[model samples]
Target: MSIGDGYRAVVDLLRHLRFFVAVAETRHFGRAATDLGITQPPLSQGVQKLEGHLGVRLFDRDARGVRLTVAGGRLLGPARALVDAAEDLLDQAGRLGGPVRARVGLCGDLGGWTPVACRALAGGSGPGLVVPRVAGSDRLLAELREGALDVAVVRHPGVVDGLVGGDVVGLPTRLLGADGPLDVPLAEVDRPLVVPPRRHQPPAHDQLVDTLRRAGHDGRVLEAADPTQRAALVAAGAGVALETSPGAQASGGLPPLRVRVVLPAARERRPEVDHAGLAAALEQALRR
Candidate 1:
């Protein structure tokens, strides 16, 4: 009456459970084999081996179709749950070897701040970005709330309800145009304004519009998605554009044009996420 003598069997536990589940679901060995993409003989042999290991018959054979025995009926639910948990564990294990991803959104990458923030987040080592999505400030904020983005670096005057953030830097802005001499007051310039889409950054849009109206312009503006396009329109004498200060453009190799500091710099910050560790990392990155 040795312990090993009573129960001696070798079986791949997970494989046996999977085979049992397939057979239990179909109730027909032939149908189960077809579903599992295997031959009926191996399926029958696996089920027999599983029953021998458990020391109980899991199914009843008849002329119509197979049916679950008392033991099989009791084990089906737990077996399915176990298989699901095992697959999920395997998936997480595969991700453990890869760098953790942080989805970041940007409001037009103005003044080249988006790249700077991304480098800071990477800390010079590990996976950097999951393809930064560019949208208006309003859309970016909305994405942050919807759990689509882990963080976002956006401009001021945009609504950020139910989110926490910290200002990382201030990007001083200037007016670009062909008609005005560089360094004049905003009121002295007289050119149709070329601005990014107002729907994306309404606060900034209204500020510029109101400021120009006081200067005697009719409050008319042309919309362009790309800063380069804005600069092109201004260069071609189509209109003036509010853009990053001249100092910020020095390294970007933008087309040369008359520039004057008008509106002050906009604040750049990151929206909060749920995880404390990740939020701390983002705060640290913005500080850099």
Candidate 2:
């Protein structure tokens, strides 16, 4: 076989090349499996496939562990180099001509994350129009502080120093449960609440709490981070969870939740921006 063709044959091997290499570096099959978060049987099979492709043994096994054969030693650096080069290429693409990426928050409170930003996902990523997802919350406050996101939709019970809310709209706070729409006022139900923590509290939670008490029943907020978990808890007949305008119902055992504005007390909070210029550019692009 030609030398270039031989190299290509070795390089084209599937999964086990890395598995074999990891075992060689770690000097233990168990360690390699742990590193890859997989079981050792599959790791052994991968190594076997890789060795078969090369027509040479890749490692020397012993009572203690494994060590690389001469053939294995030769392949290690090149394999790692290939993986690193691919990662670098991807990172560069995300930063350059890929899309107009932004971190935006959308909650019952009509924050600065305009419909335009969320709508970008409907369109593919390109020069002026990539709505790559970061997260969905005023939690942009954290990302903005870390300088990771270009702009974010942030809301407050009060004002932020540098950020400003976009042409914001007010979302109605509603009582949501496992079935269709709920008609009872908050004072009537004596259920626990699934809610975002105060640090991550969306505007609807605050209104739900206040409206519940005013309507006559006391309100308490139970904290859960994942939406599906909250829905599951509700399905288990745990209690009533608050629903905001933008979030949709999750599928499976969870009943489609109900929503209606039982109170007029709550209002919309504004999302703040740091650089008006970036916000303006994104907003303009999103409008298209």
Candidate 3:
């Protein structure tokens, strides 16, 4: 295609990418239409137009509704970025002389250090507004990579390309039991293990799994996407919960359980930044 033709095509793709993203996230035409405040037919047509422009099928339709095709999956990350960037552009245009805004993502409080970090960032005399988002580690990391987030606090945040982490704090790991504190050895506990989902932070999960295995545990492991839910499970005698003591306490009031330090400490995931200013700010926050 000629340069002019390619440019127009790109513009057209941008126009319909929002519809594609809505459908991909909702996975249902009707819901996507409702969310987009448009009729189902037009929404479907817009998606079709996008598919035609890209020359790839974005979704597979069946009685089970819609599912993203492999091509769709590949496009999802970029599509989301396009939509976010468009929104940001509009926001920035509206706020033309306002302070710069910084988007921050937090992965489930990062063992109660999140609040402190927030305070540190807020206390900064810098000329930027900080907006925070709370989400799972995996989702936070993905957004961070996509430029949707300026900085993020995640658990066991190893090394991410293009981003450097700072303000590392060691979180003391604990095991909680139901109804009260129990001194039961790891090998003696037979209940399921209720903890964060492994996919969100595999390194931390693997370390926990290895520790349990060494203690002779071969029971079922239950995945809890939220820390409060995991603590609730422990309170109900559903299973044992392994997490930072402060994090579990921050989750909410729960049934009393025996608490023991299974691991002396695990480092809290702090801000992953691309700028020296952000790194310095986070380091200052960690000191508080």
Strongest candidate by lDDT: 3
The candidate with the higher lDDT, 1 or 3, is 3
**Which ranges in model 2 have alpha carbons more than 4 Å from their true place?**
1-99, 105-117, 120-128, 132-138, 155-159, 202-208, 246-288
Q: Could you tell me every candidate's TM-score relative to the true structure?
A: 0.50, 0.45, 0.56
Among residues 3 or more apart in sequence or in different chains, the pairs in candidate 2 whose N, CA or C atoms overlap within 3 Å are 100-130, 164-272, 164-273, 165-271, 187-217
What lDDT tens digits, residue by residue, belong to model 1 across residues 86-167? 6688657747847546666767736445565456556644245344666767667766654456666676655554566654
Q: Please tell me which model should have the higher TM-score, number 1 or number 2.
A: 1
Indicate the residue-level lDDT of 52 in model 3: 78
Better of 1 and 3 by TM-score: 3
Better of 2 and 3 by TM-score: 3
lDDT of 3 by residue, 1-288 (tens): 322687777676676898899899899998886555455887888899888778899999999789999999999999999889987897678479465656777677354556766666667574246787878766776666445666666666343434555545545445568875555667777887887788877766676676677777774688888778887888988898755534333222222221110110112222332244554565555443
Per-residue C-alpha lDDT of model 2 across residues 1-288, encoded as one tens digit per residue: 323666565444524556766787799998787655455897898788777766888888989668888877898888677656755776677578544444433332332234544554334542243333333344444344333454554333322323344653233345567784455766676887776554553553565567557667677767665666777776776777755434433222222222111111112111222244445544444333
Q: Sort by TM-score, best first: what order? A: 3, 1, 2
| Residue 251 CA displacement from its true place in model 1, Å | 17
